[model samples]
Target chain A: MKKLFAMLTVIALMLGLLAGCASDPKPTKPAGTQGTQAPTGGSGGTAGSEGPSEDKAPIRVGVLAPLTGTMAEFGKTYEVAMSMAAEKVNAEGGINGHELVLEFEDSKGDQNQSAELASKFADDDGIVAILGDFSSGCAMAAAPICDEEEIVLFSPTASNAAFAASSKWAFQIAGLASYEGSYAATYEVGKYAGAHDVAVFYMNTDFGASIVENFRPAAEEAGMNIVFCEGYSDTETDFSALITKAQAANPDHVLIVDQTSISNVINQIRGIGWDVPITMLGPSTSQQVIDLCGENCEDILTTVSVYYSEEDPEAYAFAQEFADRAGFGATVMAGFAYDGVIILSEAIAACGDNITRAAIRDNLAKTDGTYLTGPIKFSEDGDIIRSYLICQIVDGKYVIRCGYDYANE
Target chain B: MSKIKAFVGKHRSLMLTAALVFAIVFPLFGFKKSMVRIFCRILMYFTLAGSLNITNGYSGQTSLGHAGFYCIGAYVMAILTTRFQISFWPVLLLSGIGAAVAGLIISVPTLRLKGIYLSIITLGASEVIRIIALNWEGVTGGSFGIKDIPRPTFFGFTFDSPLKFYYLFLGVAVIFLLISYRLIHSRVGRSWMSIRENELAAKSLGVRTAPAKMMNFAYGAFWAGIIGGIYAVYVQYIDSAVFSLDEGFNIMSMIIIGGQGTLIGPIVGSIVVNGLTELLRPIGVWRFVMYAALIIVMMWFRPQGLMGESNSILAGAKIKMRKAGKTGGKKEAIS
Candidate 1:
């Protein structure tokens, strides 16, 4: 009886496995990339599908993002953002008359998965360039694959300083931790001049450590006495002990260098009745952090590249349209993803009809002046060199306190 | 056809050799670089799952911290190679030994404790290792991970490509399988099974359960460590995120879904689970859903797994026609 039951189960699983394996790899409609927000302004309804240029093959660009796993929500928004950007490109006659078609592959926020997808995307000769794999770890993991295959891996959100210099094929739109970390210390902390009673709380991960590496030197140079400095694990949620320690140190200001869980630390710090002016670096420049921390999120100064209230017509249109389409205000992730498409297009355009990965990368390095955020260009390292706007959460939204060119008094 | 069968019966060993050659060379014919890469991973899981089966399946010890040992092997490989400039071959064995040392530490509680408590200890150990990998920035590279560890080399030639790594690890996986086969069929293997069947009876029969179980844990962890080292080189990069508890469960699932205790079971299980993972790519997030559903439906129908029972044919139950006679039913042959 047990043997029979086991046989039946084996047969059932075998059938499912066979069926799943046999379903030939066709492009399934990616979750968030769909028929929403009818192609506005650029080319209303003459979308590439039923066009005279139907004979021209669509130029395929692969998007490797966390469409699943812990970063799924951000990944989905990135998909929507990428789709929006692609549509805008397609509406603008795309690159040399071939419409840009994005092939969405889920990295599942895993290193192995990201690497696998990178190889898969690279293997497909039709796929011209690859954009993103969200986190720096995923991006770095995928970088070797792209490097070996000689393809572009333009990461929109990977923020590791090591990754930029790792591979020639890799390019990061996200600010390097070194520059942003030092910039935060010199400008943000130095703005208070003397009596710098800062309590620095950093995540003990590589990303946070890299920031701390630069922040400490810059802090000392600016004569900021870091009274309470603590390196907490990534899974640390209850910051009550850390907060009490910071409070006991009698700090009048706080510096949070973290990702995602910064909100929890901020809310707990405020909850422990240790209210003070806060300075957050890098990824904290998001509306998600603001929404999560609620009232405690206000007056938190952040060095940001994706300010929604930027006084630029193009930035406003993209942000407004993206927010309306994605059902949430544009975060730095969405903004960079949107900008990544623009950067790719500019690079592809710079290739001037004979588009190749090498040409695209070469053109990418020559990206001079504002594409969306400040004066943008690639440094000697593949990282983008752009000054960030200093912003604060006022009321319930992001309010830019100073422009990218804002100098310390 | 009757004459052919008679001739084949006379030269069955030669036919088996030809079949083995065909089986080995078949994948190379359709080898896309991506497919080769995928197969390398499939082989990795195969090796890992088989090791887990040594303790989890054979001894009935549910260890939720299998990936912890995997982490040890990987981190050892990562640290030694990048920091000390050690080559891959020696590091492979060192990693296995490193993980075995970790297994020895865990076996103390695992042997003394009962059921769920043992599982909790293991789970705790796995998480602690991951946390260490995250915080121990000096050696493990913190969360940035140990980047650009050199690829495995043969003489002076680098096993840098996926196809090269696939063949290298495929041989290693087969060797592991062979070692496991020998271990399972040995007197020690019989003792492990006896312990699982009835610890009191096995103890009464002069079996030292403590030492045997400890050996079993170390043996299992040794395989996991080797595979983890291979995985580190194959992917060329690894971090704490690579060996989360989910991966521990994932390896456990492959053995469970494939047919827990049998020799060929894990090999088959790893192939199917990892293959399904790749095949279900178009489904995006729903891939895991489909995978879980298949496993659930399979378990509901057959609690013994796909090839769990000893005499099951798909379980690779070898047909030894010689010694066991015409009714070679009860005394199952090893595949």
Candidate 2:
């Protein structure tokens, strides 16, 4: 009995000790918990006079990007831009005294991860808008969630035209592939005189197909004949077969919209030695493309939102600020991301304390901005009515050909 | 009452209290949305791992098609809730039952095989399920996945809130733990141990090995289905992405690292693996390398697991035993 008592006592003590030791060893809370520090308590310094509480809280916007992934270069740059916009907004006495807060969540380049991150953002009870998901797939997955919950989404670069028609909630800020295709067609017909045969080699996905579909119609309209339209899947690394087809077509120039398999495609194109002219589209036209293609990248024509030539004083100023913070050249993605946040800032300003999803949506619909991207507007379909800048590789860089606005054209 | 008697009598209540405290207080330690999301995930994987422990650990069957059952449950619940607009509770229950039925069917054929052969067949079964989920684009959303499967709801309250969802999960987990405990203590559990010890001997003792094994598989798969259903609702989405070969590997890793036959082992293993993944994100992609290394080390040093075959209660007693042993010796000399 004594032994049993002793045994029980000892066990009890040990159990208690273990429980104490095991009780939730929380990691030290990082001072800045990324997205939690929203401007608290609506603007009122006048001694406790009960005014509408709606006049106080900042508009909480979520910036969902691959803070970490294959697209982290663009994602991290967007973060830097968004951060600058927030800093600028807050510094300028805030929007009607309602400061803008951008909470950054790393979507980790997975649709499931993006969905979960969006859900988390929605749960914060403060978020009026969300900007993200550089990839169309991630954006596509997340759009419904935001839609169902009624959160305004201003995607920086999920430019799949299919998404434009998918949801009212999906408002893409960059030019869609259809727009890119039309631009490519206009450029090819105007420059190459519509007599030379054009070959289209695009990635085998909805993104690639949308652009290709647009290309055929516009090319035909411009009287430019397609020599051969070949599709390549993401798995096609060598691209020997596709390039061989392009060369066999005997085309003066080829418009290639595939970058799912990068650098290798450029090398394959160079290997074909069909050096009439080559044009590319989608988010793959940048310094990285230059780095990937090297000497092979010259004379390659691509359409972008804007070039960072430090030309437009507003763009140059923003680019300098971005470079100072992000430690990289301000690419189109960074510019769009900057505009995405600044647009939110402007919208929030327009809405004042009524920064609900409806209000944000209304404000976005009403937006007419001379942003860094040039004359940002939104179509009824929620596609950004932004200009497409034609870019050609010159002296190992993306030189601006000319800017053409969709709204104007 | 004597202290020993009192402690023994109060054991269940004490455990209940401890669990309640742990569940309630856990979220308060900084409800980082990521952490909350991870907590929901931990509850999910824990449920799956615990269910897995019933067949693979207790019954000593190396069934690799647990993910198939999991996927079936997920897809069923997702399709029912999202498409048919079924209520969350019924969908969850029906999905679990559906998965259990599927498990029984799969078990009938594969139970005849033993060891690696069974594992291989079960793996094939899981892969087949994955392929179906991928190709059945009209239903399963192909690689694109189904989105916004409604969050769990009960009575007038909706579990749309993470905090509410967390509590709902805790309730379900507690129920599962109770069910698992009751099942483990039953005569069927003893029969399972007999079969695990020596199937031939168990057969000699009129154990009806086929039915018994089928029962284990069914029960194991039922819980897996429940986890899947809850997962569909909790994540509010279901697709081939949620149910993949990698997920199968993750469940397998949980069972291996947590200690195959032990009850508490699966929970510990889930936390260790999942927690490490979240905590070691700073190490970037190499975190997977670190996790693999940790698992390898665990396998090398402690093949029987940290808790071995001992129940958590028994492990608690053993600690007491060692402490008493040390103190008693010292006291005797002093006396």
Tell me the alpha-carbon RMSD of every candidate: 4.7, 8.9
In candidate 2, the residue pairs with backbone N, CA or C atoms under 3 Å apart (3 or more residues apart, or in different chains) clash, namely A42-A56
Candidate 1's residue-wise lDDT over A103-199, tens digit each?
A: 7777889889899889888877777899998888899899888989999999977888878788988998777877888888888776632338888
lDDT by residue for model 2 over B170-260, one digit each (tens)?
Answer: 7777888888777777878867767777799999999888888999999999989988888777766456645656678888788776667
For candidate 2, the chain B TM-score comes to 0.87
Q: Which stretches of candidate 1 lie over 4 Å from their true place?
A: A1-52, A192-195, B1-23, B310-329, B332-335
Candidate 2's error at B262, in angstroms?
A: 2.9
lDDT of 1: 0.78
Candidate 2 residue lDDT tens string, A148-202? 6777777877777655456677788777777677767866434433446888887
TM-score of each: 0.90, 0.68
Worst 10 residues of 1 chain B by lDDT: B314-323
Q: Candidate 1's residue-wise lDDT over B145-257, tens digit each? A: 98887788878899888878877877887788778888889988888877766678989999999999999999999989998888888777788888899999999898888
